[model samples]
Target: MSEELDIPEEGTESLYERRAFVIDKGQEPLRIDKYIQMHLEGSTRNKVQNGIDAGFVTVNGKTVKSNYKVKPGDEIILLSLVNPEHTVLKRENIPLDIVYEDDTVMVINKPANMVVHPGVGNFSGTLLNGVAYYLEKQNPGLDEDSLPRFGLVHRIDKNTTGLIVLAKTADAAAHLAKQFFHHDVKRKYTALVWGDMEQDEGTVTGHIARHRQYRKMFDVYPDGETGKHAITHYRTLERFHYVSLVECVLETGRTHQIRVHMKHIGHTLFNDWEYGGDRILKGTIYTKYKQFVDNCFELCPRCALHAQTLGFIHPVTKKEMLFESPLPADMAMVIVKWRNYIANRKEL
Candidate 1:
């Protein structure tokens, strides 16, 4: 089954433009509203039904109601009648670390302290703005408004430095989006947690959602009570008594998945401010140790996490591709300090 949507240009009063799709021959008869909602990402049942009520949905060139039963070979067209909130997108000449670029996709190594996209309080100085500028410069005829500003197939946190994949064309965006949705993309992260795990390797599974009181943070719902399903598999690479370096492989990508999952299991990522890792979780209460930990925090001010590797199939050429990045200087330096501390302890 295939579905198509014509996305309206930025600053346009027409909320959504014309979009059409042909139902699969093997598809079962179902309500048109339900089918559309299921096919589109970030869509709700109420939104789809409202579109139908506004006479924006048609079947076989006839306007249909929300309850219209869709059969095999049905040609469905939807004229979006809702207003999309305008996002403040600006073009800034920010420097970008382009790892690879082709007609289909571009892989970028995003630095820490950089926001992936502009939203809410952040209206400028983002990776998206920089990328948009780069694309516009590459081709003068490119529509700055129609360009894939939100074409990021995946994103890292503002404070977490890592590799992020972006799609240049709509076809590449859809292909990469499906790969991420199906958990076919390989993602591995390196993190320094506050405690050493008893097991060398383990997996954490829970439902994750925004925290109840702290809207900025996330929490694990173990009983599947709320939020989306999340899983993180981790292996201890090295132990520094109070802190441990671990490699985390994501089975499901949820917001703050590695950070929350590690905190759920009593080993929060080192220097993570939100989940209580900023303060020392292990080690003695001596002034010397306190100063040492504080110095380490100064070395890596943000959460001690890095996206070390990413792998996916090429959207255009249909070839296997993989990329790896070494730990940023801050993370690598902190790890070296920990190794020296362990060495000195052994000598003592």
Candidate 2:
């Protein structure tokens, strides 16, 4: 997403416009809601104020109050439901592996190859579609509009499998969103990466932003010149010569944080096609080694990353809640193959 504002041309009416603005260096501090009303056409102070109250407006990805002062270079994003670009969420009968559910929240063990929400190319058959269907079935009179992003507080990549939490009500959504925005949620992931880590454990710190050339990919900016600050702590679990199983704990949640951070430190996740981990980055070039890697790739065709653990304070209960999921079949099988290969080679 660009840090530039999407101001419509003069006299144009865009009631549902999704607006983004990067405050200029010379910008003076102004109340966020007032600033928005001044810049947004066909908008009232009441509407902007209401949007801020409803968490529809964010400053640097964190929800803020109407009175919050917009500082220089602050990235402000405002979303409106009336926008034509926003898709009407469809309720589909897609299957969901729901791990836990209550009146306030729902935790799901998302499968690989499943998009979290409907988008341009994937307008249906997403996790949100199935969640809509399930929520409606559970409560026949449930209002979909009351829930933002279909109750999604956070999301993993499409090919990244594992635990995700969803809010069931507006109040719950607000509470969960606040927690995530403040980085209060505890998230841990298991990743298979190329090469043996130089240290048993270390931290990767950098700013993450969309690549200048590759729009679909993100890159690390250590100079603090661009991107949002992100931090990831990782520790090796087991080393398999050419690959290592590792656990990652995130302090800040940014797009592709773990994947990009791991790659930045020269240990890209195994078979992470987006970050150039699909081919052999380490180990011998023997034909036998190539064949073994090919078989492993066939076993796990997607990125070797899994969100294994999630922890947060329950919106309603106000108590700490934690959940864990085992690795999916494909990843587990590939790990087992690496283990067996190491053992057989040792015997030989």
How many clashes in each candidate?
0, 1
Predicted structure with the largest TM-score when compared to the true one: 2
Candidate 1: C-alpha lDDT: 0.79
| Positional deviation of residue 56's Cα in model 2 after best superposition, in angstroms | 6.5
Write model 2 residue lDDT over 238-348, tens digit each, in one string: 998889999999988877889999999999999999999999999887899899999999999999999999999998889999999999999999999998898888543
Q: Candidate 1: minimum summed lDDT over ten consecutive residues — where? A: 7-16
Off by over 4 Å in 1: 1-88, 148-150, 346-348
The C-alpha stretches of model 2 lying farther than 4 A from their native spots are 1-85, 148-150, 346-348
lDDT of 1 by residue, 1-348 (tens): 754544322111112335678887888889888999987566678767755664557799887889888997888876442233334457779999988899888999989999877666666888888988888798766654344322566678888988888878755755676577567888999999998787899999988888999999999986648877788999999998889999999988888899999999999999999999999999988798899999999999999999989899998789988999889999999999989987887432
What lDDT score is found at residue 116 in candidate 1?
A: 78
